[model samples]
Target: MIIARILILLPLVSANKPQFPLGIAVYANPEFDICHRDMRAVMETRDLKFFNSVIDKTRIYSWPLKNFKSDIESLHNSPLFQLVRKMPKGAALHIHHKAMVNTDWLYLQTYRTNLYVCDKHNHLSLKFFKTPSNDCNWQALYERRRNPLVRQVLEDRIRRQMTMLTEIPDRSDTNVLWEKFQNIFTFLRSFLNYRPLAEDHFYQGLLELYEDNVMYVEVRSGLQKLYDLDGKIYTTTETVNILHDVVTRFKADHPDFIGAKIIYAKSRDMDHDELRSFLHETVELKKMFPGFIAGADLVGHEDAGYKLKDHSSLLLEVSNWTDFFFHAGETQNFLLQPTNLQIAIRHNAKRIGHAYSITKEPDTLRELKEKNIPVEVCPISNQVLGLVSNLRNHQAAILFALDIPVVISNDDPGLWGAKGLSDDFYMTLMSILPMNANLYSLKKIARNSIIYSTLSENEKAAALDSYEKRWQQFLINVTMPFCDYTQVMYSWLTLDRNTW
Candidate 1:
């Protein structure tokens, strides 16, 4: 392996390197795993760069693909993408398996081969496919293009197909996005669950995410359906088995997935004890699959009055091996939002999923900063939730600017109707947060993701080196080749730092 040794030794020997730190989207929820045409379409909107200082700047390294024209040219005539493919990215911190994964693949697994999709009007719905017939199909969902309400339903279902090409304004400022967000889940759960849909969705979603350059995804999902009795009841074990099976099969397929972690979440509208039991059972079940299972969380409308503080005793009682990841400060409706952050940290949370309001409390902000905690900044989620109407003032800038380990993610890319991580990064880089867009800065963001992730130290180191080698080689070739960025923009390269 002389070649391998030299490859590792290469970067260390270079000085004044044009090398870029490895970068990645970290996480693209199955809910938000839209493909290529959809990704290009999303980046074309007027508001795409409506918030970034670099709105007029030539696209480069991190989000070049957002500029299909330039990227396509580079793809054919330049080596930027070749370099990009070599860059290493760490783990994707946020994901919702059910919503993030593609449902079509799931449909196929459970013997759902037929079609019940509405045409002309544009809508799709699957019902008892096996009982009826998979062979005699009326029309696939793809062919049917239903009307208004139906279109809205279909669009919502496929929102992860890509970020919406046009902006859809926030419906109500006061209604927390978390409130409206869960409806997507309830809607999907209410509609699909007959066959082993989780497996289909998980695989497809992972494939979509991998295509977007996301290696590891920590999926946060509400509990899989425990039962669907016609006014009948089934033990929670049935649901657990279904979830376990999905993970088992998924792991069999995607080894680099970094694995899926169950959120063991529940809607706050349910009985608290019922939720508690699920949490406890999930912790107990972790014995069956150690590293793959992450821990528990409580989501749904935050105003529903079931605070993490309420579960403090249970949380303290649980072993540290079973981590706690909370969705805190997602609400403007309650002052208790900050308190949730406090409890999350005090209880030793692995990370805060969407602590948007944590900055409002000066002391808590200091604590978070000092602790080196990461804020899972989901810009689209915040916009959709109406906590912040524009990316211009998204709190991610505050956390990131100050060097708080912050990682950008597509919280529910599917539901937000967006593609994978890069599009989100492009939107944020070009429009909103004026964070530095150079190679080192982008790599640091990627490192923060890995450093702050729940992955073990060995895993993080391995991922980090893997990313470094890839990026270095890509960049090295750029300098040696005829059309590298440095040579092509020799004039700009020597310009004052302020010109950037």
Candidate 2:
């Protein structure tokens, strides 16, 4: 009787054991398991090739274990990156409007007619001038680029100034790095904000994402007034309408494209009255273009900006009018009083941007998990901005381990010459996530992007349906030619389609 009882308990315990560890991978189906095994083999083969080719053989082989700008070329050449580029990312929830297009493309716009450049206080500014002005010693860009030698030198200088790439990425101070980062946007604003160029820029930005297999995007736009070379200015309302028209035109051309939305953003350093005025304007815009305007956010360097708690009353008052997707906890200082994460949660933000320091606050992490608020993880942006030296040490890895919701995003991809979500996804997979992470991990993160979006319930359902079809096709395309027929059939037989 004792032997029989022990045998009975043994099977029960064995049956209760989990097939995989807790976290996003736990959701993997048998079909994904088969595909994952194949992907891993390819990854290992490609990685070994990369390791052998490194000039210093003594250096360890770790893809994306270095600075993003430094490794971008190699990443572009990577087979894994090609695979990720083809993967259907549901939505990009944390991109900024100003830096959406590649800098190289924006630089080409400088060659257009009627554009002028000015040098004042050792700062460069571009503007559309009807006639030349002596204010700040303005010169026509057309004339400057007339000589081939001068144009080549000018292009090189402008390209370097427009990007944060450097041979030595470790800046003496984080503040210095941020100054350079902001300065890039300030210089590019003139090119991007021009009326005709702005329209094309927005369209091309959408096309860039579409080509990379991303179906939807929510842009954090300041809605800065648009200007023309002809000297006419567009109001904020008109700017909103122009963006909507752009989306309409884009969707008409690409029917499968889900569309784009704007998160009206303002500098977090605004005084109370200034913030209030922006908030009221945001509310009116949302009312005017409910579908196009997803919500609002306060964007700037978190360390130097006003705390969310300082203007909590005003933020809370407008919560009903528009969703809040505040940028909180992007700093290294996790111990600051009234942490931005805490205040953002208290104010009911639809999603938290970055949350880089959340690992230090277990209580806040638990609250975010419990509340089901997904944090937009911009791994490259964090590394580029001096937040983390290596992608492996990023906090999103910890969050993913605990099964917290995370949506990978390219915060300002264009600034770094990264075109779409692929590079960020590649960095997350190669370094930030566990070695065992595979297609299922990508699937879960992709699903979270759509599920956590500000899209309507009906829209979410349609997007998911579309994502499923695309996902099925992707799996078949990537696995069928390489996978064993019998094994593929067996995995397909056991797959629970509803679970995904």
**Per-candidate RMSD vs. true structure?**
11.1, 7.6
Model 1 lDDT tens row, 258-289: 55556666654456677567667777867665
Query: Which residue ranges in model 2 land beyond 4 Å of their true spot?
Result: 1-20, 26-60, 147-150, 482-496
lDDT of model 2 at position 467: 94
**TM-score list, all predictions:** 0.67, 0.89
Q: Each prediction's Cα lDDT score?
A: 0.54, 0.79
lDDT of model 1 at residue 178?
49
lDDT of 2 by residue, 349-376 (tens): 8899999998888899999988988899
Question: For model 1, what is the error of residue 182's alpha carbon versus the real structure, in angstroms, after optimal superposition?
Answer: 2.7
Candidate 2 C-alpha error for residue 447, in Å: 0.7
